[model samples]
Target: MKVVLASASPARLSVLRAAGLDPAVEVADLDEEALLDGATGATPAAKVTMLASAKATTIARRIADTVPEAIVIGCDSMLHIDGELVGKPGTPEQAAERWKAMAGGRGELVTGHAVLRTADGGIDRAVEGHAVTGVRFAEPDPAELGAYIATGEPLVVAGAFTLDGLGGWFVEGIDGDPSNVIGISLPLTRKLLAAVGVRVTDLWESD
Candidate 1:
């Protein structure tokens, strides 16, 4: 059986690799349009968990044959501010704007991951019950926001920032796994990987 990661996020990829796992990569190809259709008062945690599950299930279904006997991991994250879900910024200006609004103030970085496995011809799914992390950002200057956007990192990332890169300086502190801010939490990944009998330590000797 093989282990596959269903995402195109470099941050997630990097995180997994750092944990000594060389799992396969398959993008989730998730579409957020359907998930954000007027939550009407959905909590940020609820919204992101839903999106994460959708992405995981979609990828699991798509790659069923490709890895029929393997475990597939799907993950998604979102920025929550003032009870609003902030997806990835579609444009540079939008990213900059988000940075301005979230710069000085603090917000929650909620990342939800879903682990899907097939056993006995049935699917076993695990939601974010394994891990959830909250991160806070330091005050960012309006000018710096624009500068950060120009780097193009914020364009493809949620919350328009990367806690592992230049954006790290802007974070005064974090309440959870710092890697979670990058996209995926290693500790969480390790825990979930265990359900499939893959230990974080074992990956060190994986081929």
Candidate 2:
């Protein structure tokens, strides 16, 4: 079966590519803020999963006719710290402030995944789940934080940090699937694919 990734995240695409599946990328266009704002009383995991499902559903409809037979994967991530949930900081000052609050603290990085099996121009099956990884942040000195922020790497990543990029310098360690912290979880994705009646290996690119 063909694999389709309904996200624009290079990190997620890289993860899939490294795992042997070359997926087609189709960025999902949605009002993320509106979805989150309307997700009242939902837990962090639920909220992320809901967002993922919405993304998958949106892309599935768009490609139902052109790419009718494929498994569409959608993912969303957020960092939950001290009762607050945060996604991409989106601004240097906000990223800096998020770092200041996250420094030397532990947070849960939750990634939501949605897998949809599209067949005959419609969704034939669906499965959704989430993964949470515990992140241990190292306190960065003022100069280090300032210089890192100047690089602007944190502004576009969840929780204002990254596990495989420059932000790794400030992450002391992680408990659970490291891939999850990178924005997608291989193990979880495999299980989700199976749940949707597709073998994970079937989606791998042939050598």
Candidate 3:
């Protein structure tokens, strides 16, 4: 099956490529504010699942003509601290503040992924369940937090931290999939792909 990625995240793209999956990109600017609204009541898994589904479905509608018969994957992630959803920080100050809060604390980074089949006039599709991973961060001094934020790595990350960047220093360890923190979970991606009868290797046999 042809592969389509319904996300504009560079990290997610890098993860997919590294996994040997070469998928076409069709981005959708999901209404994240609306999506997060009233989400406090949901478990972390449910929240991520909802956001992932919304993103995948939105792109599926947009790319129906361009990639019919292809399976589109949509993914979303969030940082859950004490049952609160934390998203990407839009500003440097916000990034610093979020880091302060997450420092020395363990949290869950839930990644939700969906696979939508655009075949048969977009009538058939399958969405994978939400994937959850646990991460721990050692407490950092204010100076370190400021310095990491200045590097601009935390601003674009879902949990206000990037395990592959300067933020990596703060990571104590992870209890589950590390790729989930980066943006996509490889094991979960493999499972989703195989469930749809396509493996990651199939996408990169030539490349």
By lDDT, who's the top model here?
A: 2
Model 3 lDDT on a 0 to 1 scale: 0.82
TM-score of each model, in listed order: 0.86, 0.98, 0.92
Estimate the TM-score for candidate 3.
Answer: 0.92
lDDT per residue, candidate 3, 70-167, as tens digits?
87888988898876788899899888778778888999988988877777566375757777888998998878877788888888889898887778
- For residues 83-181, write the lDDT of model 1, one tens digit per residue: 667878989878877877886677778887777776554566554532445666777666776677788888888888778888777877777777777
Tell me the deviation in Å of residue 85 in model 1: 1.6
Q: Which candidate do you rate higher for TM-score, 1 or 3?
A: 3
Q: Looking at model 2, report the run of 10 residues with the lowest lDDT sum.
A: 198-207
Least well predicted 10-residue stretch by lDDT in candidate 3: 118-127
Local accuracy of candidate 2 as per-residue lDDT tens digits, 1-207:
677899999999999999989988998889999999999899999999999999999888888888748889999999999999999998889998899899999999999999998999898899999999999999999999999999988999999999999999999999999999999999999999999987787766341
Candidate 2 error regions (>4 Å): 205-207
Model 1 local distance difference test score:
0.73
Displacement of the residue 51 alpha carbon in candidate 1, Å: 2.0
Clashes of 3: 0
Which scores greater on lDDT, model 1 or model 2? 2
